[model samples]
Target: MATEVYRESFERRTKTVRYLRFLEGLADTQVGPIYLGMWGALAFFSYLLCVFITAIGFGEQVGYNPIRFLRELPVLTLYPPPPSAGLRMAPLQEGGYWQLATLFLSLTLVFWTIRIWTRAVANGLRPMVPIAFSAALFLYAAIYIIHPIWVNSWNEAPPHGLRGILLWTNHFSVKYGNFYYNPFHMVSIFGLLGSTLILAMHGATILATLAYGAHREIDEIEKSDEGTHRAQLLWRWVMGFNATAYSIHQWALGFATLTAVAGAIGVLLSGPVEPDWFQWACRADIVSGLQKACVP
Candidate 1:
């Protein structure tokens, strides 16, 4: 009996290993092309889910209605249904599905980023860039999912989760003047723009090099190493960033992550926390007050 048990365990372990290997192989080929498609599908269904709920006028707790409960299975929403789906709240549907979908997407990204980071480390390449990107997504997801739970009245009025946070931003800004006036929001905006510019710079530089070296006949460039060397030299001379190209990605990742952090801080500031950002800025007259303070 002991021998039979040991044999079964060994077989199971072998099966597990094989299964993992097979999964790894599939991850390499299948995951690359289908990732964007999956994201698009999620976004589409999430929107559709919202429309379905709003059309039917169903709020949280389908409440023994089989059709309504069945509707819940299709799309995920981040907020509870508004008091009624019209006026300011018009077109908004509340449910946990959208929030759940965002979390799921973030988790998928984190997993792939970890895989890339690990492979980079094993191959003696810098892993922190990928790891940092993953960290940003994790932080963003955490802020979205955990904010509501932290608030006491998530299920009731004064929304508190992702939806609440966004609503607060919009509500406060409209009541005051502009969300951009908030310091944290300004920082987030800058970070977002800066990340985009950096990515564009990198992409354009690479494309320029490829364009410069291309030939009318494919054989002309493919058969010789000279064209490749010319392209590299041109890129170095024009961009003057050959050595630091690798570091650019790390910087971009850091900036992108900081954008998320800034947005989270901005959300906290705009909410009904200790001090309202718009109110404080307006009452304090920070700009004029600063000038007066400097008038020594």
Candidate 2:
């Protein structure tokens, strides 16, 4: 009996290893190409979305967004008297609040997803329809990469005054926002959007893929096929949920894109942006390269 149990355990271990190896092989072949343009596009689109959100949500006063919090805190500063006599500049429109609020919310959502979505994916009840999954994959991955890059840009800023420091901390000015020299521009903004884009596409491509697959699964069931029907149904539900999430993700991306573009435009016209210190990382501005790898 002991010998038999040991043999069974060994066999199961061998099977598990083989399964992993098979999956790894498939991923290398199928998923490798997917990464090529997916990351770069993801970054560009998502960054745009973030900028749009920050601009409109916070209103034109988007520049002083961080000041609100800073002013309320322990720091004391001399209050400048309002424009003396008729010198008032059209009350600088201020509206970056919502953008900042949403950023926090989005961060929280990602945190919860790690706790919740990660577990769900791990449980094997994978619902993502292929196309939706692909698009969403593009969006979120970009968001993640951009966040860090943007933050680092702020910290690594060339020496400037307190105003510059404050502006860097918040989206006071995208040109001065510190991410002007992003290495991201070099790689091509293809797939950097990651999960955010994937989630957005989930509603359409993902939903369609799920519906088609589910309908076929149900048909198989009606034909008296057994065992896999329940699994198919579960997968169908997963796809639907993903579609719902993607819808929200797309909404966020749309918002972010508009915000970022507006910010980029404002800064570009205002003055010189960051000097490209890492020009080597910037891809050669070659037409062939653009056609071949940067087309997306």
Candidate 3:
């Protein structure tokens, strides 16, 4: 019976499966793998560029040679060909370019999500999960783009403009000490981590019990239903309460949305408003020795 089911699933998947189409394409065609490889390389290089920009910016502050250090740190020696001088520009003067690039990318994602939502609505296929998650991320991006303009004036503008807002919120500024102590940042981190964990659990549970061969059989829906029931039973055994699939969807969406919203709140409350996050967090100290040690 298991062998029959497995053969039927394999045949059906070969004919109908779209989820692994991209992977299949890469495996089947030389051009597909080359394109995928190029895209992967581009993504890696983009990350390297960002890291380079960050290292240069911070290196200027600490009077360290960014190029020499980056090259040597991996191999444990400073003896290497020198990097280009263009990348050695003063941090304050050139670092804002990286921020501009990042800001533009964030705005692009927000606009892209908006486009997706609009297209879905036009097609009468409104997916609440995508829209909700996109809306939350849009707000997160908006915090970076709008907060600096809203908070700072021309004379006392943040040094790196919008990026300065993120830098300070992340406690890159000395005044804030550490953003980990900030309640909102902590909440955001937990939300992000929790959402990831919940997503993994849901995916694992569903995949483990899915009736792959019964997807096209209306009468065989009992197989799918039974699998889902088994998954829910497993979840109940583990969690002590079985949420319906719809309820689980809602919980996943809530976790994802909260992650972005909490992060935005953390950014909004940083820098000038809450310069010393540690101090703010330690304001109402209960333990006497700890209080005196942290306090002035």
Candidate 4:
């Protein structure tokens, strides 16, 4: 009976692999992967450019400069405020800029590459567990990495840990009018959302790939055809988990979306009013980050 069951299971798995492969063949157009890959690369490079810009001011002993400020400022005003001013101003740490630049450049670049590669693999129906793990790892890095750099750049020191996180998010919310505010900062919640979208998609793709692999593996089990059924069940569960995980990032996206809608409505409802300096900076970061996220 066991042998009979095993035979049936192997036959089913063989059939499944053939089906998936057939699906791959049918979509012979290079367009999907090409476009997805291109968009991902575009988003990644743009983020890098923005990072470079952001780092330049603070990367040096003097931090937080707008390249534009130089072209427009009087020669006397060229110097950034002291570090305590919450501006990443003059007197860069010895090799601090190099270390900071290298860290961000490597982190974003590596994650970007890993994301695109895993996407390619998932698109091709290869096993993709490594890729799924990579996406999650990147998010974990963001949660840890982003806060510290931001706190340091501030004129004032951050309180500590979760306080810092709440402070940063809250600062944006009030200063920029929402959690997703990136207007003057030019690093919009939108780009972050877009990046988040990419992250979510990558996570989904990874799970799909692994499931496909597992599907093939389980089909070869020797138990009654029950094992074959279990494989199908397992595949769905993996897929479900991916969908759920990806949804987590979508909340951030949704917040950004709401801000956009509100901004648009405000524009239609009222002409622009001059906001204060803090607002302007907040807006600049949001906008700059958004544009940079698409660089190259």
How does residue 229 of candidate 2 score in lDDT? 42
Per-residue lDDT of 107-130 in model 4, one digit per residue for the tens? 665656666666767669543444
> Which sequence of candidate numbers ranks them by lDDT, best first?
3, 1, 4, 2
Provide the TM-score for each candidate, comma-separated.
Answer: 0.48, 0.25, 0.58, 0.25
Ranking by TM-score: 3, 1, 4, 2
The alpha-carbon deviation from the true structure for residue 93 of candidate 3, after best TM-score superposition, in angstroms, is 5.9
| For every candidate, C-alpha RMSD to the true structure in Å | 12.5, 18.8, 9.4, 17.2
lDDT of 1: 0.53
Predicted structure with the largest lDDT when compared to the true one: 3
Q: Write the per-residue lDDT of candidate 1 for residues 150-254, one digit (tens) a residue.
A: 442233223334345567556656643456667877888899999898788666655555655433224334544544445545558877745244476677887
Number of clashing residue pairs in every model? 6, 58, 0, 38
Q: After superposition, how far is residue 62 of candidate 1 from its true place, in Å?
A: 12
Top TM-score: which candidate number?
A: 3
lDDT of 3 by residue, 5-52 (tens): 876666664643334556674563212112223334444555556456
lDDT of 3 at 90: 24
**In candidate 3, how many Å is residue 44 off?**
20
198: Cα error in model 1, Å? 1.1
Question: lDDT of all predictions, in order shown?
Answer: 0.53, 0.37, 0.56, 0.43
Stretches of candidate 2 above 4 Å error? Answer: 1-103, 118-214, 221-296
